[model samples]
Target: MKDLFDYCDFGDLKLNSRIVRTGLWESQREKSGNMTPDIYNRYENIAASGVGLIITELYSLYPRDTFSKYSNTIHYTQFVREARDLTDLVHVYDVPIFAQLGFVQYNKKTQQNMKIEDVTIDDIRKIQTDMIIAAQKFDFGGFDGIQLGLGNYYFLSRFINPNFNTRDDKYGGNTFNRLRIVLEMIKVIKDNTKLHINCRLNAFDGTTNGMTLTETIEIAKLLEKYGADFLQITLPRSPQFFTRENKEENPLIEATEQIIDNVNIPVILGGGANSQNQINEMLNSTNIDFISMQRPFVKDPSFLVDWQIKGNGESFCKTCNNCYWKKTATCHLRSCNP
Candidate 1:
């Protein structure tokens, strides 16, 4: 069986290993939402540490979507120029970078910050067109690929989310209907750019009556049909579906298996996969294609190279949720949940 260090190619980009520096909200950016040299240095450090792919913490596709007073938002020409510098830096270490696109109208942390009004058919079409335009801009700017945060439901998630989406319209009814927006959005972008597009699906929404496994698999199927290069599967800590209780109990492995069983495309699972033993098992399963964890990266971004070389199983992280809390507290540094 191949270990986590094995390479996996997704489109034109070739990963030297399957170990992705998962999208942990590092808060390493400046308060103005620009990449500080420290964040750049962190990327450099991770690349030098030998991570196969460094998917960034969420970067807003539009400046208005930036909720973090200090996160690195990529909705500006200035940000685009600086992003090229960061990617160039990553390439120097022979590591690839995938900038995660973000938008969160159903943002639990800052619902008050966002305004949500259901759209008419005409309005929906225009919004979709705007999203396509935005994607084109980001692709032309020279990023390798775009990771759609659809699973977390910036807008599409809300539409699919039972708690937030209450519309009777075609865009917000059943699970299949809710996914249409993201599918169309991805399709339009794929139609225009050769750049790889990855779609994230919520394995569990973390709510009481939120998203279920069946619906989640359906979402992944839609992504596959749309020609998504990868399916980024994650658990959403929602108020109605996935909950804090089960998120701790279930972990990502079991959830990843069910998702991988449904989709033929490569499936990427992240969130609390803090050890190499689990990562190796994921690779050996022949079901899961990638083991992506965020918090462990926050604890020690270079831990991947260490584990890859050592081939040990114990977790390097202290199980700290600081990366999540720091974002809530508006702190640039991780909360250090240990």
Candidate 2:
């Protein structure tokens, strides 16, 4: 039986455990995305907590768009330095880390009100270059690989989804065409660095018009072709599901199984997978090579450590989705409000 603490060779990276930490926003950093002592302490604590791998939250490729609200800007070099410190600290524990690169949309406010750039090919190229630059820096700073948030509100996802992407060109079309931008971006990163890269794909858009299992499987094939060492699949329901109050299967794990069958590279299952029994089932299935946990750890970084020590898991993941609606930050690193 493979224990959570067991180290495994994943792609080109050596992960210390099968239980990998997914990216969760650590507002612990300064508003400008600069490394803060609190954030550093948090990483040290998590790394020390017996985790095999920790994937940092999405760092904006464009320093000007670091904050979700698009109000503050992070310093590129300073953020890199702080990121390096976190990497070095974690490496002492023999854990591998990955830095996620993303470009956030500016709804209204941005430094000096810089005009929101359209999704032009030039914009995509520049963003890809920035990610490559970040990857080289991360490798030098002691990170194992780089991952892209390909199908969400971040730039790549924004460009993929019809909801966020409205342009009608080669970059926009039926699913494969939409994937062109994402694949090209990955190629550039690989061309620039010798590190492994992970690209996470949402299993479902939870909408009638967005991603379906079919679309995701097709996307996964392309991801592997373009150089994704591993594919992390997650399912996120839209607000419409909450409004309709419909409760059926989330289809995340099921979709992951399909992706596993279709792709040759390692496939990871994440989202709502926190329990011991659930984790065992996923690992036992032989369909998934690894599992990623974001909410579970964000709620309680100590959960895994405690689970190993005392068989207790009291995490702060409310899963209420109120953090977006109430407009107030809810999961500020601690919450048992479930």
Candidate 3:
């Protein structure tokens, strides 16, 4: 039986638990994009807790992108220095941390949001080079890995999706071609940096002609082949689309299991789980070894400590998603939970 708290090997890194804490909004940061005391304290609490690994909130690749206002950007001058402090704090607990890097829109000068088909080869090269530089920053920051935000509505997600990327050039058309843009970047990052490359991907986009599980499986294979050290299976809208109240049979469980069977690298089933018993059930029933959570940690950074002590505990997170929509790091409804 797979236990949620068991020490395991996720790739080359040893984890204290199977739980992986993934972050989203960083509304608490300064307008200058520098880290604040609150951010450091929150990370310290989470690290002191029992999360196996920590994936920092989305680090916007560009400053003008849609989510940059709510996320930390690599363009920040203090990014490397502040990130070094954060990573060192997490390492004190012997927990490995990954920098989540992505952007929703591709805006250049005055072009605003560029369509996937309209992106020129020069644009593609620029994006790849920017990502390589960001990876190098994380490498200097002492991060254990980089979680490429290929999932959700990120630009790369659209660039690789047939529904959005209708280009006929070598960058688009077939699966390999559509993914070539990212695969090439992955190879570069692997050769250049030692950071473990983790790709966060959508299991299935419900769009009529967008990504499906079959294509995602193929994408997973391609990612693993290129250099991805691990994968996290998620949906398009993700946690917002999946709340605890839905109770509908989660398609992600079966989808993630199938993905795990298809790939040799570690696959994490992302979101929609809250209780220790529930997570342990999935851990034992499926091939999934790592589970990722966001809102629960936002509700209480040290909740895992309680779970570890109690053996079985349910998260106090109301799943209201105020933190997600309001774009705050602290939970909005936690005071009412008790």
User: Model 1, residue 71: displacement in angstroms?
Assistant: 2.7
Worst 10 residues of 2 by lDDT: 107-116
Please count the clashing residue pairs in each candidate, in the order shown.
Answer: 12, 1, 0
Per-residue alpha-carbon lDDT of model 3 for 211-231, expressed as tens digits? 989999999999999999999
Please identify model 1 stretches exceeding 4 Å from their true place. Answer: 62-66, 106-117, 206-209, 238-251, 313-315, 328-338
The root-mean-square deviation over C-alpha atoms between each candidate and the true structure, in angstroms, is 4.3, 4.3, 1.0
Which stretch of 10 consecutive residues in model 3 shows the poorest summed lDDT?
329-338
Judging by lDDT, tell me the better candidate of 1 and 2.
1
lDDT for each of the candidates?
Answer: 0.67, 0.65, 0.91
**Clash list (residue pairs), candidate 2:** 316-335
Error of 3 at 296 (Å): 0.3
Whose TM-score is higher: candidate 2's or candidate 3's?
3
Top-scoring candidate (lDDT): 3
TM-score of 3: 0.98
| Candidate 2, superposed: residue stretches over 4 Å from native | 1-3, 63-74, 106-118, 162-168, 237-249, 312-338
Q: Compute the lDDT of residue 77 as modeled in candidate 1.
A: 53
